[model samples]
Target: MAANGINSVALPPKDGFASGPLSPGEPAAPGLPLRSPNPLTSKVTSVLSTSYADAEFRDALGLLDERGLANSAETRRQLRLDIQKEVIQSNGDIITEFGRVADQLRRIGTTIDKLNRSYQEMKSHVTAAHKATSSTLDEASNLIAQRQDIEKKQHVLKALREHFVLSEDEEASLTLTSEPVDDRFFAILAKAKKIRTDCEVLLGFEHQTLGLEIMERTSKHLNQAFQKLYRWTQKEFKTLNLENPQINSSVRRALRVLAERPSLFQNCLDFFAEAREQILSDAFYLALTGTSPSGQEDRSVKPIELVAHDTLRYVGDMLAWIHSATVSEREALEILFVSDGNEIAKGIQAGRENDLWRLVTDEADGTPEFDAVKALNELVDRDVSGAARVLRQRVEQVIQTNEDTILAYKLANLLNFYRVTFSKLLGTQSVLLESMSNLETEALRQFRSLMRDHIATLQGEFQHTPSDLGPPDFLQESLKQLTSIMKTYETSLASTGDREADFQPVLAESFDPFISGCENMAKTIKPPSVSVFLINCLLVAKAALAPFDFTQKRVEALQSRVDEHAEKLVASQYAYLRTESGLDTLYDALAPLQATEEDIAKLRTSDALKPDVLIAASQNLDDFLPSALMDAMENLRHLQDSKLTRDITEEATEKFCVDFEHVEEMLISADEAIEQGQTNGHAGSQDGPQSLRALFPRTTGEIRVLLS
Candidate 1:
């Protein structure tokens, strides 16, 4: 039944199955094979037929057993036949069910055959439809192409029939290439002109593109040209013609030759103006930003300052070479050196910054950027200042080391070195002149400072031992050095034609301290010694200052003061010598001496000035006749016959004479007494008749001794 569900029949093995129709020799149908008989079936059949009566088992049951056994055997036979019938019946049922299955299978096979046929027909139809579609598409494409061709041909034929059809004379006109033979030729010429005009218009478009390309190439060529020119300039100007005496004129002549023909520089001017902005921008960016162009690492390229400076110099030289170059090249160079698209004026502008003038233009008023002379001067200033600074440092070092003396010649040597080096590197006449001027000023300043310090030190030295009034060697030597320096400075200035070489002011200024110092020192000494040494110092100072014309008056003034001091000292000494007490002592001792013999004997033994003492004092006065004070007085009188000393001496002398008159009066009284004695006839005794002459020797001797 399970096999019969799909309409297939199962039969015994003796029968063969068939699906559609069975052939005689073919294997059984695709359905399950027919069932074959097994041994169990046969065993069951045998068991059904078996009986105990057939052998000893039947006898062992006795009569009842025999009867039962016979009955059983019969029953077994019947059962065997029943079993065989049942077997046949089962076979028949199986074959019947198998037939039913075969019929159902046959129907299923027929349906499958029909479905296969339908599938084939459907496939064929699909193929046919695809072919028809492809053919239709091809036909459509071809029709469309043909339609387009037909339209194009129609359009062509229409044009040929209407617009392209030419008259015989028009065709002849087209063939004409030269002078017109007739009206047709003239028409052809007119068309030709029109064609030319059209061609020219078209060419303008072409030229626009081509022109830009040409300009690009030309720009590159110009750059390379400029580069070569710049390199050449660098080489040529490595040492500008500063070595040659006529370098300025030579260069100017050379530039003038170029400037005489301005047309020759037109191309250069155009290129320079066109390229300057870009080049300056590039240089500026590179200098401040350290940037380089794409793919280039030349950030260390030289700055534009030198390029601008050199370019301006070249331009200036050219202009200066031709006096008319200013008027001619002003416009060209204005464009060339323009910054910010604004033209820099020819001269420096008051409102414009100086740095702007660094790229100065030729039209500038005062100092053109191209002025080589001015450039040389500016460079010289830098070099000289640098040299002066270094020389000053060296001089200061020398000053520190050799403070005792001035380094005037050494400074001259340094100045010479600076001049030579400047000339070798950056010299001109103007430069040298200016540099010397600066050198003189610097050297003088430094020397003056050195001298001032020396004088201060000398002043200190004088102040330390004012009584030691002699000029030390160092002092004299310093003065000598100062004189030498002044001379050197003056000579240098004179060589440069400098009219302001007067150094008298410095001399007087430096001497001020010394003069005041002497006076101060003089005041500290005692009177007599003060006069002595101060005079010597004054004379020394006068000698020291004698070289300076400006200091003559000052020296004379010092001499005058010295004389006054001497006279004052003298008067004080004379006053002390002739004091009333002093004269009274003399008078008391000598007044009692009479012309009598006994009084004269007493005067000889008295404490009065003895005759021998008087003689010695007189001799000493003679020795001191031309005293130092007197000499100083005479010297002062010679310097200026001023009455200051004379009045002082006369006043002091009158006081002295008054004191001496008392001594003279005592002598006179003595003389009178002696005379009276004589007159009274008392002269011949041993103690009588001693005259005043016995006590006093010479007439002026006593007065001279009193004065001493």
Candidate 2:
């Protein structure tokens, strides 16, 4: 079995046959008795047996033996013959079975193809049907919506007609008067009438052509009634007397009734449309032309009386309606107030106030006019406090409802200027404060009104909550400027020896109400509470400084105490640290430090242990600390200067600047440590001098040589 075909076994000959040929060859070769095989032979036999018995070799040999037996010529020939016969029979059977299988597969494939075709056809049919159905449904829905809208319009028209009580007799008697109704009024009336008629026609068409089973005829009649009422309102306005005291009041009443419960009236649209024009015209004529055509002064009419009466009536009506209406309707009306009515009233009031003041102050001559000026000035001084109180009340009221009103902003701004002016008037001989107060008051009132209107409009349109009202950039700047002016005014007032005590109470009284109002309002606002607090603090500090004499050490000491308190308050309130660097790196590390108790405990034990950690902590408290401290110091310094002979402003400013710079320097050092730690990837860790030097590359080379 070896590849070389070497004989591996050596066997002894059979018994007594060992001699080569036992022949007469040279003395018979010794009969070599068969000797047992050598131990080496046995060993070789065992080795060969073991090697041949290997499973792999044995398997191969067995396979070879089977093949050899199978390939023997006799067996092979017979087997070949038998195999050829068997193969022929088997192939016949295979061919028969294959034909059967192929036929079955063909049938199955054909059936599947038919089913697939049917499924695709059905799916497409369903999809097409669904699309057609959806289209029909959408058309029906649109038609329903249109019908509903038409009905609503008709209903409104009917209500308008009933309210105006338009009759055939009145329509017949209507004619163009000497002072013809303006074309604008007529145009609006015509538009209202046309809208009514259009609704009637549409209703009729819906009934006749569309076969809509509804009360179309009744709706059409209602629309016609509204049209008549609209025409009557126009006629009434054309004949109205602006000079009659009762006329303005009546018109306002009518407008309110119409605006609030339009649904109750049969001709609501006609009434509203006509009334809108009439009210404006009447208001204008009453404002401008006080007398009638007879040339007698209209003794019965006063512009302020007319406007105040009408505006109050209008506001009352609106409020009543707001109370009665559904939440949604009330909201809608409120939006309208913000968008239209409030702004108009504010503008009219401002113009009226300006004109009245101008007339009252006619040329600065020193006779009765001078006396009048002085009296009015004194009156303004007295009334300014009252005005501030009223304004604060109004602001708080508006803020309390979680509602915005243009009136609120207007009031806030007006009060701000009034307070500032009052302080200035009490302090300086220069009329600058007085003039500024007047101008700023006017501006602030206007600004407040505008902001309120804007906020109201936004609230109405977006349904904004109280939290939505943020102090816009303009408002913030306005507030800041106002604060600055007040601060300056108070400083000036404090310096004036004659009126120092007088100004202090006035300033406190004026600002206390405003601060209180703002605080109350802040509950309903967003982040502005912080601003309110800061402003209040500023005002308090200013007021405190106003009465204290600068020359007295007691005043200075009191001021210092106030400053300290302010600084502490700011530090606690802001919870910031004073540092040179910004908080980015410090904050990032502090987050992880907080998660680890060991780090926090370490910080508590050793103040200087984690420079980065401390820096981070300090940064959080820094924002309020410096500003608060500065404000406190400024107040104290002002108090001292008031009592002293020195120029207080210059000294206070210098000290503030120096302290602020020191705060900045401290912040810088903390930031530097944080940055170093960040760069070295071991924030706030204590490192050896060498390691620290390596972390800070600039120090590396010098420190390395020293360490070596």
Candidate 3:
């Protein structure tokens, strides 16, 4: 039981003693001494001996004894049996332990299942609680929103009752009304009433008027309700002693309605103008005076400067409003212009004479600021040129008569108004130009359609043949007619004037027709003309129509002309080749001919033509076309001499050459091999050379030798 007793002990149990003879104990050894075995070692030894005690073990032991000693065999056998029995018992113990582990695992699984069920129940409760809370929150939010909406409606109703002036009869009528009114209708009625009340307060209604009576009654009630407003305003102004001229002027304007004299109304406007001018002049002085060598305190205020400042501010506002009103309510403005011409004229005259220089320069006798005057002059010149000119002349005359500084300022103010009016006229002119441009675009579209139709008709004429003429003659006539059409297009284009409104459509129609006719004629010809006439006509049309800018429509027409002509030329060339060389039949015979080549070459190689022959035939066909046609093609190519066209043609030609070279090489190689075998002595010999003629004698004999 010592920690390291096994390592310190001897390898074998020596004399069967516990440390050999039990260290002088009382018990004497009988046959062998009892050894104190290490617990771990004894367990291992028992397992090994038990496992080796069977018949299989006996045989192994016998074999070991045969190789060595038989005397020790019995002892070994006994030890092996004991060890084997111990191993069996150990294995049984392991099986029992495993069964206990399995039982424990089952209990754990059962506990886990119960826990999972509880957890699921908890999760369901949590989910339900969350949903309920969310629902409660949503309901609260909805209730709050409803309350807010109600508050807003109440506020609107209160504002309407306080602001709107309704007569006793009208109020009674509203109450008696049984029909249900929507919110939008109520809002509209409220807004209209508010606007009418404001207008009545601002414009001052006559006492005899029904509207005045209602507004007076409403004002009386409002004054009673707002009795503390004056005290509030006084408290607000206490901390700031600055007088707000704008507020004072607004009050004055409202009160002016009570005074019915038109002259008094005019006086009020004059007073407002003077007050506004004073404020503006003060602002200007405040800004510039600090920057001057003379300090801010040195800047002086004058009556003329105040008048000039007010005039400029008023003119600026008037100009802005006029600009907006002209666009939004042009008819209303026109009525105003007719009814209030004298008032407007007088205002303009006063603005022109205003001494703006005194406000800007802070000098009473300073040269009148002509900037506003100049601006007014420019505006008047653009919008109402005649009126502006007359206004300017009158201003100069007035200046000469009154050399009064006030009159000068008034004239300057009037000039500013003229300038604003002129600017509006210029803006109107721009709008007009934009409309004209759109109209031109639409017109051009219509013209293109008309041109395309005419061209289609001309194409028909070129394709159709007369019954009296034979096929060849008919084709020739068609070609002639097409050429004539081209000539007519050229003539029409040449005579068309640059300024003529009808020129574009006429020339487009004429030229487009000729182009289509030429294309159609090409289809009927033996060889395509590839004429430059169509291109020439297009160029001429472009030139004639050049005076009218080269719009998208014209460019499209030109592109169409080029495409049609090119397509027809290619088609005609293909058709001519088919008719002259019977290439169509060759295509059909290709598979059969290939089969025949194999048969003939098998029997006699001499009969089979090489691929070179087919290549030469194709080359000869290409070369056989009329020189006139080639020249025409060259001329047609030259027609695309412009930078844009040159790029297109070069690319097309390069691609065509590459494909043609590939086809030529394939045909040539095949023809050359066949031809060499047929003519050469080495191929003609039966057994001397490999020959297709020998292989396919039947096919070689039937095939006609057409090339030679």
lDDT of 3 by residue, 1-708 (tens): 111122122123444434322333456557863554454565566566654546555555555455453445465455445445655787799999999999999999999999999999999999999987997889999999999999999998776565664545434332333322233323433443464567465445455364565567655543422222222223332332123222332122222221222333334333433443343334433332332223445434432223435433433333343343233222322222212343333433343333321122334564453443332222222232222233233334433443322223333333433333433443433322232233334333443554454345445466653222222232343334333433333333232354234334544444445545545554553333333444444554444433343233665676677567655545444444344432333333332333344633432332213334444444454454334234323533444435424443333334333333333333344445557665674655545333322321222111111210
Q: In candidate 2, which residue ranges exceed 4 Å CA deviation?
A: 1-226, 229-281, 284-296, 300-442, 445-708
Candidate 3, position 93, lDDT: 95
Cα distance off (Å), candidate 3, residue 396: 37
Per-model TM values vs. the true structure: 0.33, 0.18, 0.24
Question: Which portions of model 3 show Cα errors greater than 4 Å?
Answer: 1-550, 553-557, 574-588, 591-708
Better of 2 and 3 by TM-score: 3
Residue-wise C-alpha lDDT for candidate 2, range 590-645, written one tens digit per residue: 33443234553333344332445444444443443345434433433322223321
lDDT of 2 at 596: 34
How much lDDT does each candidate structure score?
A: 0.46, 0.40, 0.40
lDDT of 1 by residue, 592-615 (tens): 554556764465455555555554
Candidate with maximal lDDT: 1
- CA RMSD of each candidate after superposition: 27.0, 42.1, 39.6
Q: Indicate the TM-score of model 2.
A: 0.18
Candidate 1 backbone overlaps, count: 13
